[model samples]
Target: MNRRNFLLSTAALALSGCTTASLLKKSTEDTIDYQREKVSGFFASVDGKKLVVLGADYHYVMDQIGDLPQVLQSPLKPRLNAEFSYFDLDHDNHVSGQVTLQLKGKVSDAERQKLQMEGFECKGFQEEVWTKVYKVRGTRYLAKGFELPASVSKFNHDYEIIVRESHSPGVKRAMVLLTPVTLAMDGVLVLGGIVLAPVALIVLSNTHWR
Candidate 1:
C-alpha cells in the first residue's frame, strides 16, 4: 500500500474504533440511568411470619441493585428496635392484633399542621393484624400486627406488612399499595442487584478509567 493510503486507512480504523467505544459507553450510561430511576423500594417478608425490612430498600431487575438508601431521616426517621405482634381476635378461626409505635424526632409546628391537614389516618386492621401509621416529632413510625386465621396458622403461612405515608406540605410520601404477598428472597436479591449494578459499574469503571 502507498504510504499516504496506509496512513489514511489506519486513521479511519482508529476513528471507527473510537466511535464504537463511545457508543458502547453511552449505551451503558443510559442503561444505568434507566435502572436508577426504576428503583422501586419494597418491604419483603422473611420466614412467612415476620418482616425483616431495612426500610427504603430499592430493587431493580435490569442492573441488580438493592438497598439504595433508607433516607428515613430529615423530618422523619425510622424507629429502631421496632416490634410487631399477632393475635387471634375471634374464636371463629379468625385472628387480630394491635400495633403500637414509638418515634423520636423534631417537627416544626407548620409541618405538624400540614400532616393533620393531609388527613394522615392510619388504617390496616384485619383478622388479628393491625397497622398504625403516624408521625411524631418529625419521625415516622409504622407499627404492624398480624394474626392468621385458625386454618392458616396451622401451617405458618407467611405475611408481609406494607406501610404508606402522606404529608400535606409537599414532602415525599411513602406508600405500600399492593396487598401483602409472599416473595422469594432469591428474586428480591436479583431485582436489587439489577437496580444497584449500574451505580457499582459506573464507580468501578470510572476508577479504572482514571
Candidate 2:
C-alpha cells in the first residue's frame, strides 16, 4: 500500500475514534441523568389502613379512603409522586403497569358509548382528572379503558418492593437488560479506537512502506 492510502485509512480511523468517543460520553451522561431523575422522584402507595409511602409517613389514618392523588396532595406537599397499585383494574396484569387515561376531542354520546363498550369510561371536563384535558379547545371527555375492580373493604396486597435497591424497579430491570449491550458497545469502541487502530497503523507502516 502507498503512503496516500495508509494516510487516508488513518484519517478515517481517527474520525471514527472521535465519533465513538462522543458517543461514549453521551451514553454515560444520559445514564447518569436518568439515574439522578429516578432517585429524586418519589412513589406513593396505600397498602391497607394507612398510606404506605416512602417519604410521606405522617398523613392521618383514615377509616375509608378518598381519591388517591387528592389524599396524597397535601401530605406530599411540593414533591411529585405517581400512585402505584397491585389491584388489576383492567384484569390485564403487566410487569410495568398503570391505568392511563387521555382526553379525546369532541366525544359525542355515540363515540362515548363506543369507547365504553371497548372498556373505557368517559369523564366530564369538570372532573379534576379532566382539568388538563379541558385546556384543549375541542377535548370534551377523558377516557379510562378499564373495568373498575370490585370495591375492597380492605386493600389486597399482591406485590411488594423490597428496599434493597435505591433504583426504581423499572430502571433496575432496564439496566439489567441493557448491561450486556452497553458493555459490548464499549468493548468495540475500545478495541477499534485504542487497540486495533494503533496496531493496524504500526503494522501497515512497517510492512507496506518497506
Candidate 3:
C-alpha cells in the first residue's frame, strides 16, 4: 500500500480496536449491574444497619455490592422492601447522639439474639461518646444506643460508631476472605484477554486492509 493508504489503514484499525474495547467494557459493566440487581433483591437493612445476603463464599457479596450498600438504599424499590426506623434523641439534624440501629435478618431466634447482644457492643466511636444495647422481639433485632457530648456549639462535626460482634473479627476477617476471590477475578480477566487477543488482531487486520 502507498504511504497514505498505510496511515489510513492504521487509523482505521485503531478506531475499530477502540470500538471493540468500548463494547467489551460495556459488557463488563452490564454483567456487574446484573449481579448487583440480583444481590440487591435479597439484601435487607434497618436503621442504618445492613444485613448482607451472602453466598457460600460470603466475600463475593462485598465485591459485588461495592462500597457496602448505604443505609438509605434498603427501602427503595427493586431492592428488598425492608423497613428502617431511626430513633434519634438529638433531633438536631446531626448524625450524632443516641441513635438506635435495628436490623432484621434471616437467622434463628437464638442466633439472632446472640447477634443482637454482640452487635450492640460499640465497635468504634467518633466525635462523641456512645454506648449501645440490643433488644430482640421474636425475630427482629434492635440496636439501641446513646451518643453523649452532643454538639454544644454551632461548630458541627460528623462522626460514626460501628457496632459489631467481637467474635466475628469484623472487617479484618472480611478482607482476608475476599483476598482470594479478588485475585481470582483478576486472573479470569487476564485469561479472557489472552484468549481474545488473537481474534481481535485478525479482525482488525481484515478490517484495516479494507
Best by lDDT: 1
lDDT head-to-head 1 vs 3, winner? 1
Question: In terms of TM-score, how similar is model 1 to the real structure?
Answer: 0.24
Candidate 3 regions exceeding 4 Å error are 34-210
Score residue 34 of candidate 3 by CA lDDT: 11
Better of 1 and 3 by TM-score: 1
lDDT for each candidate structure: 0.28, 0.26, 0.26
Stretches off by above 4 angstroms in model 1 are 34-210
Q: 1-210 in candidate 3: lDDT tens per residue?
A: 899999999999999999999998776554321111111112323222322221221211111222123422423112222221221211111111122333333445554454344443324434221223322111111112211122212112221122111221122322121212111232321111221110000001111110
Give a tens-digit lDDT track for model 2, residues 52-103. 1111111111123324323233322222222322111111111222222233
Residue 137, candidate 2: alpha-carbon lDDT: 9
Give the number of the best model, judged by TM-score. Answer: 1
* lDDT, residue 82, model 2: 29
Worst 10 residues of 3 by lDDT: 196-205
Q: Could you give candidate 1's per-residue lDDT for residues 1-210 as a string of tens digits?
A: 999999999999999999999998776554321111111222322212222222223211111112122212223223221222222111121222223332334446664453344333333333222122321111122223322222211212222323222122333345422223223343332221232111100011111110
Residue 86 error, candidate 1, Å? 32
Model 2 local distance difference test score: 0.26
